[model samples]
Target: MSETGKDEKKTKKKGKGLLVKAIVGLGLVGSGGGAAFGMMQAGIIGGEHEKEDNEPKLVRKGEEDPYAPASKDKETEGLGEVHGEGGSEYRTSYYSFTEDFTSNLAHSDALIQVSLAASTRRDGRVLLWTKKHELAIRSAILGVLADTPEEDVYALAGKERLQKRLTVAINKVLTEREGFGGIDNVYFKSFIIQ
Candidate 1:
């Protein structure tokens, strides 16, 4: 190895290293520009997308429901003035309990099962509240049914009274959980004694 040969080899190695660094630097600049372009397209940074309609359409105060049926104010449609004081025009809605209630009667070993449904002449919010608090409501209904006498399951009048009791129990639950109780009545879809 001569001195000139060693110097020439070192110079060539330095040139190769500088070329690789320059290529890497150019690659880094290109990728950075691409990232910036993407950010602008996605409206994350300032660009021509400045006036993009990305704001949310939140429900403001006093805004009416978009899907509700249009009708006259203060007057319920399809429900005009009644002739007598006995009857009033009102639409009734029913919500059936998802599961049948089965429990042992208080005084006897007999088991009673009742599939119940609640009626409401109010708005659909009552139904939504019923569904939301169903677990609590079912617990209350089962509590009443468990204490029911075995004899009450037989007589028509006794059953009627039981229905009234059940209605009161459910209304109590609704009133406790929600501010209002809109339940009109609770009827037994299927009542069984065993």
Candidate 2:
């Protein structure tokens, strides 16, 4: 082959190799960028984005929960039973104590008969009035009664405290169960310790 022809062929091959390399590099860069962009859009890496600043933030972690705002405020106006000026109607019911206390007493290994009245909210949510648990409540009352050593059943100074503890215990049980809303308060209809 002639020298000029051989030189021309060598230059053409080099140009083709460089073009292929450039195309492959571009494809690799584009694929990486696209994957990163997709991940960002899917929110896999970014922190929680804040809502609009003007909206009222509802604190959902406490006992005094703010009511969820109505979708349309005008539609809810003058709708249901009004108690005072702006008070809404509150529905409440009593769930009687029908379960056998023998089994519970055996399980708890405590000597106490506690009858409670559960006050339910309108939305069926139950909130215990205090933080005291049921077993602790029964034990406290039993302790008090044991110390007195006078009457099997009587109104004591710690009656209110006992009631609050019982309420908390009932609420703890209810809240632990599935589909349990909450317990409002617990009223002692009767109490007997022997």
Q: CA RMSD for every model?
A: 13.2, 11.4
- On TM-score, the candidate that comes out on top is 1
| Candidate 1, residue 179: lDDT | 65
Give TM per candidate.
Answer: 0.55, 0.36
Clashes of each: 0, 3
Using alpha carbons, what is the TM-score of model 1? 0.55
Encode model 2's per-residue lDDT on 10-126: one tens digit a residue: 999989988999999889888977886777677665645444333222222222323322342442321121123333244443444432132123233345555655555433122
Model 2 weakest lDDT span, ten residues long: 123-132
Candidate 2 CA-lDDT value: 0.46
Candidate 1, residues 1-194, lDDT tens digits: the string is 99999999999998999999999988998898899989998888877766643222222323432322245343222211112333435555567777899999888999998888887666555655676788888888888888888888899998988888888887787788776777778888898899
Alpha-carbon lDDT, every model? 0.72, 0.46
What's the TM for model 2? 0.36
